[model samples]
Target: MSKPAADHYESLASIPAGSSAHRDLSATELPSDGDIPRPVDLGDVHCFVQRHHLAHHTVVFEKAAIIVLGETPLSSVPGITATELRALQQETENKWKQPKTLYFTILVCSIGAVEQGWAQTAMNGANLGIPKAFGIDSNSKHDAFLLGLINSGIFLSVCLLGAWLSGPINHRLGRRGAVFVGSLICLVSNTGSSLSLNWPQLLAFRFILGAGLGINASTVSVYAAEVTPPLIRGGIAVSWQLWTAFGIFLGFVANTAVYNYGDEAWRLQLAGPVLPTIPLLLTVYFCPESPQWFVKNGQRYNLAFQSLCRVRNSELQAAKEIYSTYLLRRAQSKLDSREVSWSKKIAELFTIPRNRRAITASYVVMLSQQLCGINIIAYYSSTIFADSGFSAFGALLASCVFGFVNFLGAFPAVLTMDTFGRRSLLLLTLPMMAVTMLGAGFSFNIPADRPAHFGFVAALIYLFCALYSPGMGPVPFTYSAEVFPLSHREIGMSFAVATASFWATVLSLTFPRILTVLQPQGAFALYAALNIVALVLVFLFVPETRLKTLDELDHVFSIPTRTFIKYQLTEYLSWFTRRYILWQKNADLHPLTVGEEYQALVETDYEEEDMP
Candidate 1:
């Protein structure tokens, strides 16, 4: 082994293993002595950084170490000046002031999101023209089935192949390489889709496009999360949803612009997504590879350090983060000493308690994302508008307005996701989503000849999209990307994405018949009820994960599901009732106390000195 590798192993060996003693603590009871295993101490982490980092011998390294520990007196550390101390403090305080390279990386990821949104909206526009051009009767049951199949073909491919492929592709190619390959496939498949002579040909190309969407969707949020700092991670990670909304809006604009192009307009709409892929293809290679990817793939500490430096404003911040990430990986590897085979990793996602809880949380968010009925609007809003008595041009315009609402709604999350938190946002928005969807569905009850009917339905649909953009829209991907340990992150995310894609396929395939049988009223009511169920599940299962480092999430997920549920039901529920329902102004809800095992692994006793 190389000297650094040898030292790395030695560092792992020196850290104490967590206790295996089992305790049957009650759900509401706080853990007492020996009830939970203790994580590695922060002093040990400081030691690891000092020993392994080549720059540790310098005065700058000393100051960086003190800042990282967050407790050391600057005067106690030799060779540290007041000006140097001020710079270090500024790095943490002004969290948004990141390196230019980091912003560029987020931009690359955002373009990838735009590609995904544009691809989805292409079909939304094409749906209006394709059935007629292919001689398929939308009113015929058999033809309706065929139309649904064609519409859902891409998502079926995503669930079956693309989501599952993300892990191995990421494992082999790294995040940037996976994105590049996915974008290339999209470019080719989108062209093929536009040129298709028949429905079957278009379906085949759509399936190919699914492969790209699945890969990009699974990889981009993770890439963004890995590169971002904990303080601003939510805002940065949410760029995927935010830009995707932009892309959706642009796709609608394209569809409206080409509505006058005769029967071939659908073909042009289907090709609209191909534009964003070109920029994604050209620029993706320039972004830095994820530093966490390096740490997990191999003990490439030097390369990890370099990658971190490119994204962070200072080498000191880079040094602090790399060592912190490295230590957590080491701790996780000790806990899970199994083989690294794909099948084994998949099994671990369920078999391990920490991972299982993460899967449960991921499932709650991802499943809810689909069940909240956003894709129903995304895929078939034009058809819905048309059915509600809109002209072909009017349907396209109304859909465009819907897309604009979706895009504008996402900006709030960029501010609130970190402050309001992931779980809180989901809980807050779901009930509103349910209410708006119910209102929209019932609005169809008004007479078609009345102007209020059109105004009410359109207004309610827009409101639903607005509510969805901030909460379920961004949280699932961001939450799924961060919940799993580095060992199983790719596979865990694959499972989560697969869950979403599978349900999207089901919704796309069945909604046409649903609209036929149940009409708009019943269809909307069913999904509104589903939104309530999703809200209940979120209340019971999903844990809050905002503002925590990817490594720190291990502790959050380590708390038993039953324990978390118990706390929510007994503590949070009552608190909510008293605070909101009863209108108690001074009601306080106690924070959930974690065992030493659940505390942040990198926390130290060092206190920050006041900076002049």
Candidate 2:
């Protein structure tokens, strides 16, 4: 209940009540609380409303002031009784009782995910036939390079240009508008892919398709994160990965359905992605724009309040969120008022200590997402299965099973992501993933004449998919979306997605030749090694972000990377060894104290303020 000094309110109080300055505080200079900053607490919300005279704007602000400050009891709020206050508190307790519109927004976003997954994996079935139809001999080195290039063209475009375009596009048009544009581009590019007369034509259309995929990948997760409540944010935000897995499953089903089409099978496979884009295009406009986008982009706090009201169950809840978000944004704007250009924003990603740590964590997860070797199977599982002793139809069938298992695997994360936490899931699953990849690879060494050879290879690959789906698949996008401060969210996500895309491009472009040269066994072994490396990077760098609100996460990422690494090595490692490895019954592990640095900063500030 403590507030900042009275002098802190002078600048805000100087602004004329009901003037535009009250609404657009970004243009006004604000007093800073020295170099060391603490997390934005509810007191800041109370102070802002009181000093800025914002209570006159709407009843929402008046109610928010009462609720956040607790200066006046619930009985004093105009329309409320104690029962209504209890009900409002119950609403917070029940995170699943979200409004229908929130789910609808998630559905709209999920359709975009379906479009991405379907388009991304449609090539798995097509890979079997594209080389033959294009008259490129897979045996020849140059033709294989051509094949890899064509296969990876979309991802190449994503890393080079499309991902960079997301920030400006999302800023220009709102979240819904960006999704609409991305979906439309996907529709055109996917249709073009089906009509391609040659490999060059196919490559061109796929490259165009990357632009759409990149934008959606960068925007959708952030959209979901902004709109979702903190209690359920992890589960809901991960729907992007869940529906993507479902889309992958559907892609395989489509490929299997068209397997008998002979020369035309690959064409139909490429076109299969175009179906999901239709729903996404038609339905996106109906969903509400991200409320946080309203505040960050244009300082339209009233609109943000209205938007939150649509998604939240009660006025009190909506008011609380909008007020908190506004204060946090105002605080962030004060911290870095000079971030006027995109280049400077990008530079701040590395230049600012907190932003740099977030970037490092995001980069580790995103890069691991690709380097963990999921794409090796995702992009070319049909080819891998075919080489593992299955017939053409048999290979397609095996890949279809892989997709199904991948989809099934994603559901557990929804149940456990918040409870188990992102970092824990990765740590729990990565070693298993490494073992499965290695097992799948070594299974190829079994004699081709034996039934166990095919059985073992397929089973191990399925297990690998099961492990990857819940952890690395969902965590990268979800973590990247939530880690950055609201002001930097768009460009920060773009950078993270670009990192993932760059590695994915490398993986897709190289795996064909890796398969040809090292064979499936050695190739899988290579990825298994990379997965081990990924596990180490995750342990050393990635901080736990589970269950923290977007604003509260400012403190989480503020902890230095070296400190995180040291904790993992000195504290967590010892605890794990005692509790899990050694099976000590009484071993107790301490939670990482995120607020220690903030508390230290606070004590230092108080000491300075008390100086005579």
Who wins the TM-score comparison? 2
lDDT of 1 by residue, 341-457 (tens): 889888877766777778988988999999999998988999999999999999999999999999999999888888899999999999999999999899999999999999999
Q: Which pairs of residues clash in candidate 1, taking residues 3 or more apart in a chain or in different chains?
A: 70-606, 71-606, 71-607
Q: Candidate 2 — worst ten consecutive residues by lDDT sum? A: 603-612
* lDDT for each residue of candidate 2 in 269-317, tens digit (9 for 90 to 100): 9999999999888898888889888977767776787788788887777
Cα distance off (Å), candidate 2, residue 370: 1.2
Candidate 2 error regions (>4 Å): 1-57, 71-76, 81-87, 330-339, 549-552, 588-612
- lDDT score at residue 51, model 1, on the 0-100 scale: 59
**Global lDDT scores for all candidate models:** 0.81, 0.81
Give the per-residue Cα lDDT of candidate 2 at 546. Answer: 80
Error of 1 at 378 (Å): 1.0
